[model samples]
Target: MTETAHPAVSAEQAGIEQALTDQVVASFDGTPDPRLRQLMQALTRHLHAFIREVRLTEEEWNTAIEFLTAAGHITDDRRQEFILLSDVLGASMQTIAVNNEAVPGAERAATEATVFGPFFVDDAPEIPIGGDIAGGAHGQPCWVEGTVTDTRGNPIPGARIEVWEADDEGFYDVQYTDGRVAGRAHLYSDEEGRYAFWGLTPTPYPIPHDGPVGKMLAATNRSPVRASHLHFMVTAPGLRTLVTHIFVQGDPQIEIGDSVFGVKDSLIKDFDVQHAGTPTPDGRALGGDWARTRFDIVLAPAGA
Candidate 1:
């Protein structure tokens, strides 16, 4: 008696896709959830199709691997280089826009969602209205006054609008390296649904480029700067959350050339500075005859 042993169906160059698909599908048993099974099957088909369509080379794939690895290694406790990767590529904003399908006439969602950078310190002081948020001894005097209201045109009492931004020197609290939390405040709307604060007019600032994000920019011959804007995160009971920024009008740094694709016509606001001798938002003392500005914000409802 004689027996024959066959080399188990080897994947020849003629059938690369079938070989790849078979290997991928064989790993998942036939009893997995139908949705998961469908997703994996679709992913496998598209991925293999892409490889065949592009005729990808090993070198290209390896380079992508290295890129993802480097991006991973660059992220840390305070800095998220991966998020930056998604940001500069506009993936972050795109995802937000896709998920935020507000009704057609729903107050236009108040404002557009912008990038949430890496440096937000929690639990800012809930100071009184017209109180100052800027750390003492930094930035010019800009009185930021505004009412916080829901999409229904009603005020949002107790709504906390967390405020933060870089200093006039283009540095944030966490960037000091001296361990400080300046120029950041957490303010709650008063009973009238109003919030006011005094601070310096924000300036266009560059992202930390001595890091991975910086490396990515240099590698791509792109800039590492963001348009000048004050950051805000508004939260109220039963209200839709808002992540936004008020772009300074007429800032040369914020042209069509914003490196991260974060600029929008709607987000840009006027930073009208009231010179020394001009009345303040509340007729308070213009300490040392300083500058003043205002930015009123509108919020969208949770259902909106």
Candidate 2:
């Protein structure tokens, strides 16, 4: 029987390779923030592991770098290609999931949060409780009513209920070249935590595919269509602010896939269609066919 010894050169090469990653990790040791130092080291380790596992080619690496560079170049105040990138890749949703835990059994579930798409604007034309947020945008007239309540089913009075969405034409006000603001508004809940507003039934829209995110989706043979849904951002004192969507039930695009992966079964609701001359719940007259949807929201206590 014979015993074999490992080559010294192989061991040396392995140590050298490991040292390269260790050196980078060690460079972050002096970071004043302990959390930052840990994050940097962890990120470095995972990044190196990925590179090593892939045995990445120089050309492929350069292509990736160029792609990222182009993503930065196309980003602007109005167009956030980076956020779009994160969204399409599902990183944003994963981060939200990590931070938003589910309520345990025997307790009411808090409303699920989703990606805050880049189109939301501040000071979105505050309106009366029953006022129209759509500003006569070209879409089917829709009445949206909801109640903001705590997880225990208690009304949260005076909560801010903000709503925004694309029109029937599948374009948000921000997407207009004329700098117009439409299809979005904000209002406060009534004494009973009830909120109501006139808005267009959201239609399926393409997630701005003219930029790097669109290019990425095209390269990967994926669709950029987001499911039809209305965006809501609800806030109240002593409760966690919830950014979510009430998606239209039976939307074909949702069955396909939401580009941002923001869809949840609990968030889906029916947008009932009513014909002309039908009396609305709020006593508003409809000259033509319209849609109506009711979505009640549940908020968790702060830090819940």
Candidate 3:
């Protein structure tokens, strides 16, 4: 007895891909929306081309599937591994660049925006307007005070500034052995647009290296880290909000080689130590004196 011939696996792949393309085109064939049509067509072309360019073998494709599974496995309420994956690839910044492009002098009558790092802890303890975010401990003893202004150069009273920064040890409050949430704080701008908070200069540090994101960085031999920075989002109703970081200028990582690609010259600032005798805010002691840096932020109108 003899067996009949069976269809080759390669032939099956070719047929399925062609069928998939035909279906996609047929579904969009009479779409009258120009923008929608353009997006769909461009996506199809790039996706199909990508498959061809990579000559993606079934084994390689399976590996990709498994990688995604692992990625999901590493994510939960406190950590988002996929976002970390995107950060290392620079895709997150590119997306922001396209969406919130600061238009010269018209940069939104709101504060600037920056990356929402994977470290924000939900439900951070609410503290008084001038309370110490440094949690009664000490590092660089920085008095960060500033004003929120609009594009037309007017003050935006009542704007809220949510700020978070790692300690001098390069670890955030959430990462402390005490398992506490204190380094983060929310302060509302007072009339005349003044907002002040007491804290330490955040030190430059590395991103998490316990997952696939770490493996990706290692394979490329590129460091996974960021410069010293304080993350902030200054928001006011009817104004464009800014999600950005204030960089400590002394950190070499903020130069052209920032591992996370987050440094902007406009956002870089010097946090010099002030050794003269300056009084610490109510109820706190400065030992001798403390460090201070004044940063003023301007916001643009929502549509600007």
Candidate 4:
């Protein structure tokens, strides 16, 4: 028996798809802001290219729309599902890389920036130097000390440093419903540019995995766990704001993979263990084992 011949896709069909993409991109030509017009056109072109490359079906498109809708529905002031989705997709890290490129003519390297995870909040309680930020979060206490300095090695006095992290159980303050503020706070560097705080020892934890983003990760057979880390956002006058994380050295999750792709070799540090009954740096009475780590942060000049 002779097999039936199948016709190839017509050139007219390909032309129609290209014309549609061109029309969508051109629709943004009237945008008043040049940057906005460029962004819109680029986004339209890339998005249309993706759809065409995938040859997406109507069912798949509907599923994607439903997934995004679910993510929006689950988002609130306390939890941002969109950011989580971006993190799992590595979009957040890519944006950070694009915006935080290296500074030219710098004598010393600045601390690398990473994804500003979904848990940051405005107006965190301010604590004095060497104060505790753990509030009431449960975990082994960690003494986080660091000096804020410019690329030239000059101290940056009075820089504002914001710190936030997950507790031993991998839960952030916002994850709880009792209006608790633990494992997070802000502090200013001292006159000598030294800042220290008490926070939980970084521990590997899964990203909030009960939402649409989590579902996607699960469906794709990917783990949602992030490497053990402590978040920092440091700002000073006339310096580029720095947002990054100091990951625990030797965390297995780092080798496995950080779901958000936020790890950098330069950002990893050793968390030294202090056995019980050891004297604390500030002579605070801690009756149990604790950890300590120092992170010296160098900031780039504002326009650098």
Q: Mark the regions of model 1 whose C-alpha exceeds 4 Å error after superposition.
A: 1-15, 18-56, 107-109, 283-291
Q: What's the candidate order when arranged by decreasing lDDT?
A: 4, 2, 3, 1
Predicted model with the maximum lDDT: 4
Candidate 2's C-alpha runs over 4 A off are 1-14
Tens-place lDDT per residue, model 2, 66-98, is 989988998877778888999999998999888
Cα displacement (Å) at residue 302, model 3: 1.2
By TM-score rank, best first, the candidates go 4, 2, 3, 1
Evaluate all candidate structures by whole-model CA lDDT and list the values in order.
Answer: 0.74, 0.87, 0.75, 0.91
Per-residue lDDT of model 3, residues 144-191, tens digit only: 888888877788898988888887767777655677776788878888
**Ten residues in sequence with the least summed lDDT for candidate 1:** 1-10
Better of 1 and 2 by TM-score: 2
Candidate 4 lDDT over 102-159, as tens digits, reads: 9888888999999999899898999989899999899999999989999889999989
Question: What are the clashing pairs of model 2?
Answer: none
Top TM-score prediction, candidate number? 4
Question: Model 2's lDDT to the true fold?
Answer: 0.87
Off by over 4 Å in 3: 1-22, 25-44, 104-111, 136-138, 176-179, 276-284
